[model samples]
Target: MKREDLLFLPISINVTNKKILLIGGGKVATHKGTIMARFVQNVTVVSPEFTDEIRKLPFTFIQKEYEKGDLEGYFLVYAVTGNHDLNAQIKADAEELGILTSVCDAPLLCDFVSPAIHKQEHVTISVGTNARDAYQAVAIRNQITNLFENGTLHI
Candidate 1:
C-alpha cells in the first residue's frame, strides 16, 4: 500500500483497446489523457473546460463536472482533478466498482502509480518510486537508458 512498493516492479500489461476514463481537463489531465491515447481502445475525458491540447486529442470528451455517478464501470480511472475532495471521492467510488484507479499527484490514494518513462527506438523503460522520490527514479531511468542504448542492458 506504500509508494515505495511500486519501485522496481515489472509491468507488462498492455493497455491497448481498454476503456480509460480521465477526470479532468487542465494541463495535468490533458497530459494523462493524451498518453493513454497511444494504446487504450478509447479514452473518455469528463471535465467542464478543456485546453487546446485536450480538445485536439482524438478521444471522447464529456463536458461536465465530477459527479459520484460518473465513476461507474470503467476499466481504468485517473482522478486528476484540481478538487482534492472530488478526487478522493471518485477514487473511492472507482474502488467500489472494482475499477482500477490512479490519482495524479496523490499516489497514496491510487491503486496504480505512473512512473517516469524513458523511450528509445523499439525500447521503453519505466522507473517508479512508488510515489516516493520520482526525481530519483527518473535519474535512475536515465542511467538505465544509457546502458540500454549501449547494449549493456538488454530488454
Candidate 2:
C-alpha cells in the first residue's frame, strides 16, 4: 500500500448526518468508531463483546454476533473482526450491496484502506506507505509536519 496505492480518498467527512456501521467492538473498532462519530451522525457498532473503551461511546450498540443481515442499509461497513473469516464474509456482503467497506488488517479485501492520518481543523494530512514500513511513513509524516511548522512547506 504505497501512497500511490491509496489513490483518491476522502480526507474528511462532516458527519453532520451520515450512517456508518462498525463490526466488532474491540480496540480497533472503538478507535474507528471514535473517529467516525466525530463526523457522522450515527455510528452503529455490532459486536458480541464490548471493550471498556467501546462502552464509553455514545453510539448505538448491537451487542450480538454479526450476521449477513446486519449489513442492511448502512452507508459504510468496517470489518475489524478478530475473526478473519467473519471479516472476509462482511467484506463480501458489503461488496454485494455496492456499499463502501473497510477491512482492518485485511486491506486486500477492502475497497478502502485507512491511511495513517494527522488532522487539524480544515487541514488534514494522510500518508500511506506500502504497509511494509509503517514506522518509516510515520517518521516521514513527522518530518512533513515539522516542515509545515517551520513554514518550509505549503499545500
Candidate 3:
C-alpha cells in the first residue's frame, strides 16, 4: 500500500510520566522537544550536538551519539536527527520494541505523525495532513486558532 493510503487514527494519549526518547538535538528536535514538554515531563534527548535553545530546556540531555538500545523503556520516540539512515534505524529499533515512533520527514517509517497543535487553556486543537504537507497543516491550525480566538468557533 502507498504511504498516503496509510490511515492515521487521531487520538489523544496521556504522556504524563511516560518515558519519551528524542533522538536529535538540532532545530527540528528542539521544536519537537518544546511541544512535548508542554504535555509531558519525562523527556530525554540524545544527540552528539545540541543547540543552545535545547540546552536550556528542562528535559534530560545526553550529549552522545544515539545507541541501539536507546529506545528501551520509552513509551514514544521521535527521530528527528535529519539523518535518513539514523532515523530509519531508530524507527526499526523502536518498532521492534513495540513502541510508537515518529521519524521526521519519513512518514512511511513512522507509526504516528505529530500534528500542528493549537492550545487554548484546556482545549487543544491539532491539524495534520498525514505528513504530506506540514506548511498546510500549520496554516489550517492557525486559521482554526484565529476562529477560536474570535469566538467564531466555539467548542
lDDT per residue (tens digit) for residues 1-33 in model 2: 443355445455444566788999998888887
Using TM-score as the measure, what is the rank order of every candidate, best first?
3, 1, 2
Each candidate's clash count: 3, 4, 0
Which candidate comes out best when scored by lDDT?
Answer: 3
Residues 1-155, model 1: lDDT tens digits: 66555543557566766678999999998878666655453888899998889888888899998887787657889999888888999998898899889887887888887777777656767887668887898899889888887999886
Runs in model 1 deviating more than 4 A are 1-9, 142-155
Q: Is candidate 1 or candidate 2 better by lDDT?
A: 1
Q: Output the better candidate (2/3) by lDDT.
A: 3
Structural similarity to truth (TM-score) of each candidate: 0.81, 0.78, 0.94
Best TM-score goes to which candidate? 3
User: In model 3, which runs have C-alpha deviations exceeding 4 angstroms?
Assistant: none
TM-score of 3: 0.94
Candidate 3, 123: how far from true, in Å? 0.6
